[model samples]
Target: MEEIRKIIHIDMDAFFASVEQLDRPELRNKPIAVGGDGDRGVVAAASYEARKFGVRSAMSSKIAKKRCPQLIFVRGRHDRYKEVSKQIMNIFHEFTDLVEPLSIDEAFLDVTHNKKNLPSATLIAKEIKKRIKEVTGLTASAGISVNKFLAKIASDVNKPDGLFAIPPKDVEAFIEDLQIDKFYGVGKVTADKMHKLGIFKGKDLKKKSLLELSRLFGKHGAYYYNISRGIDERSVNPNRIRKSVGTEHTYQSDLIDTKEIKKDIQKTTQSLVRRLEKSDFKGRTITLKLKYSNFEQETRSRTLLQIIQGEEMIQKLAEDLLDQEELKTSIRLIGLTISNRINESEPMQLTIDF
Candidate 1:
């Protein structure tokens, strides 16, 4: 697999905020927040301006305002975002059919067997970035490597309209020097646990015996062990159909009241609806996800008669799902998702926002 695999990850820089700036010249070079502006609202995206003030995506709007009082909050335009996503995906198809979108702003493409027969992955990355900028008027970063893990890290190493590639020969040393927190599957919680175990960097992680790491971290421990050695066997799966699209966050405190859960569900529903609208994605199924204090996960879903949009409809459905479940524990996370099949006849539009 190593002999023929060539994976590239392309991530747009500050995607939503950049699009907002592009479509509205007045907003250019200004601090912008794309999402709800209300007290309970959370930022979906923040421009570089807002970021300088510590504003970030998923941070509460109230906190964002505290950080940057003059921040401009703009409602996200889903249709416009979907348009740009289509254009980028089309570009990926030009190189190879093995294209997997991680989200609206990022994707992985396998171009090892591209018709152009490009000799160097670096050249391919450069051409892809150029074409993306020419078509979308937005900057993107590209990372080229033999596998997904290395490619993803390489892309983030140089960002905001940059490209980087990790040759096969350099991969081992690269992984050895990488921070444990930078590993693909190591989230904040996991990173903290690693730190408690005296594992601060990849080299430290590599020192742990596989059996010992597995005993401490469960299945994920073994995964970290292999990654520390620069070994990843996952392939670039092109036919990866999105089974679901959802967003979830761990709260600083758990909530126990039914009313509070309802409010959280409503907020999550609104966010999901916005994403659905932007993607022009309508699903027959709606799902409600919950995480309890003990970290147990549960989900309830309902199949609808037709595709639906709007916060009211989604919130109502999510509420219905939640009402049917027994909440025996305090809630830590709440999420909503819409999925199933889509109507293929509706041609996805392409609009470069900024």
Candidate 2:
């Protein structure tokens, strides 16, 4: 009775690593890792060659080196990556305005009312992939389905320049065969819990009633149940604004003294303020995060009536948070974030009353 929505998930294959390879022909077909080669640096992206040696993104450079001694590490160029991302997004817009970027390298497009009025979503996906390659010299994998959940899963089925589609008729069967860990939003913690309960696949997930799942996982359980049935009502939202801009760092040695903590806070605030200035952002909220040596974490935030900026304002907020927190243990990490974006829907009301 209802028309099935046409959703497409497009993901760049080894985005950052691939970009490095494309820029340097010599690095092509070689094991390349994009990240800092420093002791404290972590791998941002690993090429397919490096991945074969068990190197992965987010792994410490030390561990990655242990995994692959010959791994070629390169520093990341955020400006270059951002430039490439813009080119790819422009290509996506050629097909549909309902494009929702998940990250710099991935996006979801609802092409139900495509510009070309193509009858088959598969054709649209092929054209998009072709365009991405032609424009950016990078390959993309695409998944076409009736909703976001199914489309995202399909995109990963055949990676590194591949396309897969799930017809509406085969949705249930396709989901039943999916591994529990492979489901979207089911991280390591959730997967371990599911395994303990003897749930290993989508079929096992489907057997549990919504109420039973809710009892086990609280609110997220309902989401799991619905996804298992290939039912995701969430639309591809294009107007999603950048919610927050933040940065954090983990110390090699724990900090115990107030002076040391304040110094670290000052450094963090300086970095955050610089970023805000570069982005032309004026936000009203400042949040401070602290993690103890024992892994206990706490966060404190202050929202102001007027948009705030500069190192002084952020540093003051961080000091307030530090004062409220108990400093019984050494601090392992500290973070600062600023947000409260002004949108067109709501009028920007700037008040001097603070």
State which candidate has the highest lDDT.
2
lDDT of 2 at 114: 91
Tell me the TM-score of each prediction against the true structure. Answer: 0.84, 0.77
Candidate 1 regions with alpha-carbon error over 4 angstroms = 1-4, 249-281, 290-297, 308-312, 330-337, 344-354
Tell me how far the alpha carbon of residue 168 in candidate 1 is from the true structure, in angstroms, after superposition.
1.5
lDDT of 1 by residue, 139-171 (tens): 999999988988999999887788889888888
Candidate 2 lDDT over 9-28, as tens digits, reads 99999888999999999999
RMSD after Cα superposition, model 2:
6.4
Give the least accurate 10-residue stretch of model 1, judged by summed lDDT: 273-282
Candidate 1 has which clashing residue pairs, if any?
19-354, 22-354, 78-278, 83-350, 83-351
Q: What overall lDDT, based on C-alpha atoms, would model 2 receive against the true structure?
A: 0.87
Candidate 2 residue pairs that clash: none
